[model samples]
Target: MSDVLLFSAGLDSFPAWHYLDKPPALYFDLGHRYRDQERAAITALVDRCGIEVSVSRELDLSRWEADNAIIPLRNVYLAMLAANRAERIWCVGVKGDATADKSPQAFRQISQMITDLSGRPVWLDSPFWQMTKTEIVAWYLGQGLPAGNLLLTFSCSRTDSAATHCGRCSSCLRRWISLVNNGIDAPFETDPWTWARVADYYVPAMRDGTYPDHRAEEFFAALDAVGFVPPPPAHPATAEDGQR
Candidate 1:
């Protein structure tokens, strides 16, 4: 068996793809709102690379109503499915981003469980376990992976049949913030939207107890905890200078 990857076709997963050099990629369609777009983006990414990597799809529909973005025990199901095909499986989990099914403890227990259940040595690997998504994007670029290829990947949590990003969503906002902080000129508004704008919305919401809609406040608070302050607005004349 070959190595397997839980590829999600987002910024985080791309670095794993780059470093792994196109292992067999496994895509899960767990009835997330963005599954169609994510699947399409993954197909496009593999096609663009022209690499001989196998992609397997699993459609496991769920009706859990926690968040449209979170699938209950998603990584566990993905790991279980992947273990049947490969002795080693990799997922793009990063530091400080663990959920119930994605924590270090969970992966360790799952690895042991897979070995015991399958009666073989099964390994679950996350090479980027210590890096944040933003850091992974930076690492990918530093490795000379083309930014244009990355632009084709999708991360927005909410999109329509057309696969257009809803700019107001927390995922969209996080994408924008991460790219800007890493000095990537992602195809977004050229107008100077700042962390200050996020604060202006988040502060009052926290006071009135309406802040954590879909954990938007928590997301922004993490960014703030990392000490991201808004930069000063540049002169309007230089806005379109194409300097990134």
Candidate 2:
């Protein structure tokens, strides 16, 4: 039986492709926003690792128009789509440390709905579901994958062709801080934006009694443990500068 990946060509999913015991046979593309870095990274990953892909199945939603990171039930819809195409295990790279609010519970809820709707058993696998970014990166490094390409995977929610990563956005900021915490300069150093806005946004939440008590605490604590002093703010040349 073949496996399918809800592949976004992001840092989380890329290593999932590499690390799955039964390597993925198809990549379910939601046709949301596209980034050149993601495209390039996927192409390179497929070539280097010999994974197959199925692309461009549209998610018929009112185009994601808002900046709010949470899109209502996006993963659930995507998981259902993947289930239709493959009956075997369907893997998602929902990292435990990264996806604090939306990992196991979200996935379990979706799987239950899919079984009810489709009337079949399908496995929703998340090998890295309980692992931290540090653990994932260490796994990748141990596997002898090139660290250079790791930076090419895109995680930015805001898409810009010219500056594919809106470095100021929450997603980009988290990725940047994650890289810094890992003691590695983010691959997008040439981009004009810095993690100052990201740090500013969270540090206050952390200092005040506003931050959530659970995974959010672990998230911020990990950043603090990693010594991610936010840099001074700088505007990117364009929103797409570091995107991909």
Candidate 3:
């Protein structure tokens, strides 16, 4: 039996793909907006590493009407389907520095749900679950993986057909800020206010007594270091929208 990787064709998954000892099975489809990039990345990865891939076009959940961030329990469903097709061990590309809400706890819940539904033993592997993004990047580089292709991997929550990145989404913004902080200019660095817009939502909530009082100072301090001024509030958006 071989391991199965829930490959999303993003930066988070790069390191896991490189380090898998079993040459795990990689899954992908045409549903996701970044299908082209995903396919290219997976193909290149397979070529470079000689890994086995089992592609399925049957599951195209991205077209269905659903929320952008939380796509109607998509991962849980994907994991269950994948478990049936391959070995029960599944690897996901989730990192600690990304956010607390989308933490390992969330995946644990999904794993438990899948086990309950399938009535079979399954493993959910998250190699970077406790590691920061910086650590992940360093690890990939240390492994001699193509670190340059990282810029091409899409992480934007917003779907865009015109550009490689949907700069307005929280994922895109966070990624841009991280690259900037790490002194790496992202490929889609055209939008300067991407991270600034994120700070906008965060700063007001902290200042107006909406966020925890303890976090206000730390938030503002980070913004100051980044030289960003948050924008005015538009409407009450959930933490999933702004932070996740």
Candidate 4:
């Protein structure tokens, strides 16, 4: 069976298109808050790259996303519909992703369910499950793809019609982390280092083992790159210090 990717023109999905051998993609305009932004990016990239991607606006999932950007079980709906085109469905699930719907277990269950119901083996998977966004970007660039094109991918979670990324949002922050670590420091509307979440949430959360160790190191490294995080104090003098 052929493969199809559930593309969103985001940091993760854009690179995934390349990783999966340029499979046909399906973009579902679910009428979310940032649909316009995402759609614009999709259009820009598609025109530039000439990739075959079908945009489906048949489903308006906006009603479910009224109070929050998160549409619960959204992946389930997208995966089921994407199976119509190809038995192998590629969804972007990164290494540190903890979302219930995007987890490995969830995909396996969903794939099996879809296969049984459709009377055919439909597999939904992500090739980046073991790789973080930063590594994914590195791989994309390693393929000799243009950085300008990847920059065209949008990862903001804001509702504004801004020309730059809202670097404070979780999506934007993660995007910044990936790009910064990959030696491509794309500009954002607000400096991601100055984002309140970095100091109050991400720094602490990543430090306290809430986030994976590797991810934390990369994040700290990114912060270190811009000198956002202060250097650790000189090694504390041991008891031998008194002798010295």
| Candidate that would win on TM-score | 4
Candidate no. 3 TM-score = 0.70
| Model 2 per-residue lDDT tens digits across residues 82-132 | 787765544555444335325777667667777788898775667777666
Across residues 117-190, which tens digit of lDDT does each residue of candidate 3 receive? 77876666577665555556666666666656667566665544554675666566556645554446676544
Model 3 gets an lDDT of 0.61
| Model 1, runs deviating above 4 Å | 51-58, 188-197, 200-244
lDDT against the true structure, each candidate:
0.69, 0.61, 0.61, 0.88
**Better structure of 1 and 4 per lDDT:** 4
Candidate 4 per-residue C-alpha lDDT over 158-240 given as tens digits, one digit per residue, 9 for 90 to 100:
87677578887888888988898888979898989898878877877786799899888888988988889643435668999
Off by over 4 Å in 4: 66-68, 230-244
Please provide, for model 1 over 125-144, each residue's C-alpha lDDT reduced to its tens digit, 9 standing for 90 to 100: 78877766667777888987
Tell me, by lDDT, which candidate is best: 4
Q: What is the lDDT of residue 33 in candidate 3?
A: 67
Any runs in candidate 3 off by more than 4 Å, and if so which? 44-51, 63-69, 93-103, 116-119, 192-196, 205-244
TM-score of each: 0.75, 0.74, 0.70, 0.91
Error of 3 at 227 (Å): 5.0
Candidate 3 scores a C-alpha RMSD against the true structure in Å of 7.4
Q: Give the TM-score of candidate 1.
A: 0.75
Q: Cα lDDT for residue 96, model 2? A: 44
What lDDT score goes with residue 166 in model 3? 55
